[model samples]
Target: MSLGRRSVVTLAAAVLLLGGCGGGGQEAGAGAGAKVTVEWWNIVTTEPLKSIWAEKVKEYQALHPGVVIKNVPIENEAYKARLTTLNQSGKTPDIFTTWGGGVLKQQVDAGLAKDVSDEVAPWIGTMTPASLQAYQFDGRTYAVPADIGMVGFWYNKALFAKAGITAPPTTWSGLLDDVGKLKAAGVTPIALAGKEKWPGHYYWAYLAMRIAGLDALEQAAADHEFGGPGFVEAGRRLKELVDLAPFQKGFLGASYNTPDGQAATMGNGKAAMELMGQWAPVVQKEAGKDLGDDLGFFPFPAVDGGKGLVTDAFGGGGGYAVGQDAPAEAVDFLKFLSQAGNHREAVASGAVLPVVKGAEDAVKDPNLAVVARTLASATGFQLYLDQAYPPAVGQEVNDSVAELIAGRKTPEQVAQAITATAKSE
Candidate 1:
């Protein structure tokens, strides 16, 4: 999620497209007059999107010569909190980063975001439908997706070989066995940033998705319930991993990219694997030693008797939506950002997964390309649990799962905790 994130209570849908928000009421290049500045809010503060985005903004302004794009970059947690505050007043930047789900729906409900359908009609056919799913609701589009990807196991092949594990696991039992082997070989089996909660939640969420399937999770949300047997089973499976004591020391307090945290741990070759999305390798290199050719990726293994297929993917991507009062130029800038050539540059720079139909050829990273192709063939897709559910329920899921991983909560207790939160919401 170079442009998106794992945080919650932000995205939403729209039932009716808004008027005057059809996009492109102004000329492509503005005439000499007062400078029209587009207040752009986004979370591309990390590389390679950070640097690539800055250069692209400069080029767009240079091409227009009369538009000023003010970019307000924020971190993951901070971005969520800030947007939440602004959303209270029904205000957002002209072009803001959106994960494009219930948050976008809420924004549309509040009349705070523009309907981008009319503006994107011509070029919409050039992008993949799956990549565009999160941005659309009730037959209307609100956001332009920049990156699309799914989460899976990113491992160190060298470490796996050292552990005598010849291949990645294909079943839940095999995964546990592999973890034990890695530990016996003096390696931390998994790199987890427990303080962050989101990374750890991946385990239980993926387990739930595996045991319960995507449709079950959606149904649970619709009914505000998580005490289902599948959820308890998911937690019990995660507990088995936790019982092995596989994560790095101090994992409970670990940060995602800090020097001693998750990405760095794996990137530095101290851990065998991590369950992460397409950004893993990029952040691995950014935060620690580059794994180079030793890096490998595999889909999360199927449970022995699970409902989800190995073909089902779990993750989301980044997109941009306009404010309801945003100038048509704002929508124009979005178009500029998503043009096939521009998106190709982002792909080549290793900042994003391919979103446009033909941009997959632009991918330069082998690991990311694996993820791209995996997504291309996925039979089902699940946005991150946090981004998929209401904010409180999502956070509760994270917190309760963390407690379970720490041996502070039982599997039944965790499911009940999440159910309690969900029902209250």
Candidate 2:
């Protein structure tokens, strides 16, 4: 589906506003004896996270008396487009948030981002090897992780209880069984917002990971070799789930905003669960629901004899990176924000999982804590497809998945589109 008019207007306004801000150079705050200004951009849509990030910037400025931070809160779609323009024009922010893997690699290749290896290596020793590896490319580290998250089932505990599901499912059959029970109890087995496309794509990616294993899926995404048995099996399994009537009715027409309208269904116990990222709690809070006792989380169910275990998750987190053209003061400001105190504050206030070691101790929310533990225990990390491939190729994958969901394309057709893009790239 096309973006709403309001969204289009907002994106246009953001681009014009940012464009009028002029190319990178000295601004009002950059003068003799003035504070060093660092422009930082992020795509945080929810309330608590928005405030938390604002607070973090405030705290960073306080710690570095002579440094200033200009926090630009851009809408998600606009943020990517704006950053791309800035990167190409050599006017990117001094320090900005970036998704792990190919997203960062693209900027690194274009020489828009700085190699922060020396600046972050000492602290890197404390990071999970897999987490560190997610942002690394060609033996150089270009970004420092801000958090790690996982894709899982975020369910309503009370709904599960009312449906007589005593425990979360750990296997494919168990999940299907639970879905049946939930449906029989008049609850929507799953809440899916397919209009966004990415949310629907998550289902396919997670299913692919479960069926094909991390290595094979990564190879497929990286090399476009989806002809392997594991890859085909993944497509078949995802098709099975799609045919199960698991999603809410008219899901293909539902947008992320639909969840808010359907809040009563989920929050009032009409829907059992949603397969989503760790940010569900944040979304719940924004929807005006007291998610206290109702919320519970569990990893996606396992596939029998699958090379990967049930605990393996499919999601990507972001990190902070300084622009190569940033001034010395901007680099120093980035260093200040990376300190343990600032990072912890960001997590505690925003409910974000910290990328640094010892930062988890400060995450108070139960769900965030669970996410932190899951990420820490992860044996491998798969960068989200959109973030793992070049933007053009990533768009093809998303488009193919959307077409498949709309019944305009088959699994083989989608897989072939992906392979074709890989070959051309």
Global lDDT of each model? 0.83, 0.70
Clashes of each: 11, 0
The most accurate candidate by TM-score is: 1
Give all TM-scores, in the order shown: 0.86, 0.84
Give every collision pair in model 2. none
What tens digits encode model 2's per-residue C-alpha lDDT throughout 1-425? 11111111111123432452322344575567766667777676667667877876787778777766788888767776687666556456877777766667767777877888877665667666556666788688887776677778889888888789999999887888888898888888887777777777776777778878887876776676666777566666666667778877777777664444333345545568887777676565555465687789898888887888666767767667778877666556556656778777877775467766767778787877887888777777776777677666666777888787777877888888878887887
lDDT of 2 at 92: 62
Question: Which runs in model 2 stand beyond 4 Å of their true positions?
Answer: 1-37, 43-78, 259-264, 328-331, 406-408
C-alpha-based local distance difference test score of model 1: 0.83
